[model samples]
Target: MGDKAAGGIPHYYLYGDQEADVELDLLHIEPIRERSGPNDWRIRPHAHPDHMQVLLVKSGGGGIRMEDRQLPIPAPGILVVPAGVVHQIDFDPGTDGFAVTAALGCLRTASAGDPRLATAAGRPAVYPLAGTGLDIPAVIDTFHWLHREFIWSAPGRRTAILAQYMRILVVVLRLSIAHQDAGTATPDRDYDLLVRYRALLEEHFRSQRSLGFFAGELAVTPARLNAACKARSGKTASELLYERIVIEAKRYLVYTESTVAQVAHLTGFDDPAYFNRFFTQRVGISPGAFRKQAARSEG
Candidate 1:
């Protein structure tokens, strides 16, 4: 009955018709179980008006259904549910964490002048943090501080709360970008493998490393690497390396006054003519032609 909708969806500060706590207009922090435990560990479809939620899942696992996508949120994870987006969560019994609800105005304040923070908060995202070298106890302590600062009339309480909130978001954004190249941006094994592969690729893409060498570095077979790149990036492992090379070649060609032969050599090719053939085969035109086309488009 707490449903507030112009379109039949429920709007709630928590899961039901609980009135907003006057003090939480800037933000509120509470244990995850306090509300969800009472609600059988399942938050039914609902949205918060002018508010967003960051679920710091310290333990337990479950899936959240946001809009049309349902993703699993394992322990040592973070969920950013943007304001006014309809969402539902079904957690395992004994699931634990803190739910920090903050107003949109507060987000704007925390993110002032930095749209990356705003952009990170502006969507519904689930990030897996296990094995990502996150400091779990430190994160827990951070939230504990948020809860404490939120509850008491301490010195600089508002400033402290906002600073903590902004700090948490910047970490999330970095992890997300690190996953994706800022990309291949999803939570899964293949995406994880792809993320690792891209990181290695970035370091070694300029040199002539065989797919097996890259795979060996990642402790996977070439087949596994190919499978991951194909699944998350829609390209094979070898293709990805080539794609990296082609990208560098294009950059040198379009951005610099370098000759195609010099660009080819810079990209690790010994023969400019061979580089021409390679670029032509991949790009449907030679490097020279592509550069001219880019220049025309810019002009």
Candidate 2:
């Protein structure tokens, strides 16, 4: 098990160096023990640049590390790791669960036309299934069906598997929102605005970076938008926009084979030089250096 770079985060294709034949838009499912058992039930800190993971813990408990936050994972819980979020896990010896990894593109497609699902797919969260509005047994059964279809290819298996995956996502989103709403005292209307802002950010963060544009689209002034975001998340609207852009830039730099200039263009930066400065200012490293560090870690 290789550790993270000396001063940089480790980028992983999956748990360890195991290669996954992940297509642009597809899904893969497997048991929790399959990958964790051989490694003493500990997964080191790593980020999946182009993939998202949902871990359903059926029994036992564990610790989950997501960037700066460390959370406990109790039995009968679901943890969603969105693309590019660094996470690590350590489970009790007998922890039983299923981990489903799906391409970000596929999740976007699955979440199309549904703002709640789209928002859930982009954010990382954990939902304890015991008291949430989710049907625990049904969700587990759906995960089992997905795993079966993934390993045993039958007629129309792809379609069936994807359908099951979507079902699971819907349930997870429902529970996730419920858990969030129950814990927060934010007004419903304010929360709804935040959700809509996030969905809009996901859609237009690339080409639209102006705070005024987002605020106008939401039918509010820039001050109102910033106030709502700050009241809910303690960050201004522009901060959130920049954070999303930086995340996308890092994802492209680490996962894709595109050149720095090309990556800048792809990430909506017209001037490659300006993009380099922006990335360095926010990420503490230049784009080329970041890519090289990721390559060294993978190597």
Candidate 3:
């Protein structure tokens, strides 16, 4: 019943699936080959809302399609990918480097003083070292040390890992300042609330909870919740939930051999007739038709 398994983006866990270490804040470091080699060197479009990824490219060439921008990943390039940026990475075959994924908001959470570190690290900056004679091997050396620290845990192991991270960030910050390759770094006041709301919405979207219910859970008024959502994502709170439901419905239609009624029931619609109308209005096709179309396309 599925064709290309429609509905939503495919989640690519840069960090291997496992129980993350709490002391390290889920920090993970691996060779880029280990992460992307099996996938034919193509990373699909996805966002890490709860993770920051740093790609250190030593050889080969590729590019990253970040939202509307396509930036080249030169040999000896360093890319700092902040949280919540939808990006797809395509690497030339035989690309060499390391991929580091670390804690959520670790880049932005600063300890007093001038918080420009947050601004510098928060932006999705790219530094191509092919043409520019930037002789900063310290960054590369630190990544290696960080990978070793991640592999073995001894006394001050966590401290060493974070120290390496600091060194890498220091280098990244200097490069960012020199090149001023600061990508769109939007600082939204309600973004934190929106992130919290999105987490809660994922848990209760199937229940079709009202805006007031979400507001109650988040300790905010319904209006404030909707306003925050609108300000951050340009979608109201209810719209986000509706989009999630539609995505789930599409997944069922494409992946499962379920009838339209079953799909509707699973998506929280008790009445099949109303569900048909809701799906049709939003997706411009009936559940049965979508499944059939997907089949045709896949065939």
Candidate 4:
């Protein structure tokens, strides 16, 4: 579904097949290309909770900044930005590329090996794929097959196409995991603290939205935690918390048939009215309206 219903953060363009239990979304600068002018192509800081993205550089140059890392892509390189990482991208003039996004549920179910991957959910592992002649072509071919199948094939063929797509991801995953293990080193204290806080938020975003609560769990002062997040992501701790809440709310709104009041409760909002107001202020649309719009587009 190319159409987007506003809410969470970046408006995802969803793609689906009948066989897959979960959908995939690809986001780029195309939706706003005209307003971007000739030299500008960029996606502002945003995150996706349920999907991971693979950015393939077709031509030109750009860079993506995630957490503490700012990687410059001078040539063709495949960049994987995992779900829920506060990240952004900037493109040079005439830059051409396609971002291949996949839902985590589909990926885990599709992939055979690696018990560790299930535990390391929602974090992106960026990789350079172009220089390697062997794996790069296969990965690109698989992505192309998925795109072609999604567009031309009938519903009956969706399952087969989805299976093929999963196979592609397995290869990518193996390469990524191997790279990480080979270069594995202990992260610094700030990185450790950031990871700890993210894990806490994943587990406790429902009942606890307190930065102090997370800080207490991590054995650090709230100010220190805030500084860590700020230094790493350029977003305050409170902003991160709100971003999580909003992402969950968006998932519920799009995937489930939940009422506005029900979604508020599911996402830790006590009052539906306040939730509606907050969502509108942040997303520029009411909860009910957003849901209806997304549903209409998907349908």
Scored by TM-score, the top model is 2
Tens-digit lDDT track of model 1 for 109-204? 688768798777765678777666677677777888888888898889878998888877776776667455321223456645765776588678
Candidate 2 residue spans exceeding 4 A from truth: 1-6, 18-22, 181-299
List, residue by residue over 97-178, the lDDT tens digit for candidate 2.
9998887657876777675785666567777888776678998998998888889959898788878888988987788668
**How much does candidate 3 score in TM-score?**
0.58
Native-structure RMSD, model 2: 9.2
Clashing pairs in 2: none
Provide the global lDDT of candidate 3 against the true structure. Answer: 0.71
User: Which ten residues in a row are the worst by lDDT in model 1?
Assistant: 178-187
Write down the lDDT that model 2 would get. Answer: 0.76
Identify the candidate with maximal lDDT.
Answer: 2
TM-score each candidate: 0.57, 0.60, 0.58, 0.57
In candidate 1, which residue pairs get closer than 3 Å at backbone N, Cα or C atoms, i.e. clash? 177-182, 180-183
Off by over 4 Å in 4: 1-115, 118-137, 149-169, 177-192
Model 3: residues with Cα > 4 Å off, grouped in runs: 1-7, 11-24, 108-114, 130-135, 181-299
User: Per-residue lDDT for 110-157 in model 4, tens only?
Assistant: 543654444443345555565544466666666666666666747766
lDDT for each residue of candidate 3 in 1-299, tens digit (9 for 90 to 100): 10111125332334335321121145788988987899899987665544667788988879887656888887788887765455788999999888888754344332123456555566687787544545657667888999999899677896788778776776666677777643433435466687778668767888855988999999999999888766544457887788768777887887799999999999999999998998888778887888999899868
Compare candidates 3 and 4 on TM-score and give the better one. Answer: 3
Indicate the residue-level lDDT of 226 in model 4: 86
lDDT of each: 0.75, 0.76, 0.71, 0.60
Q: How accurate is candidate 4 locally (lDDT)?
A: 0.60
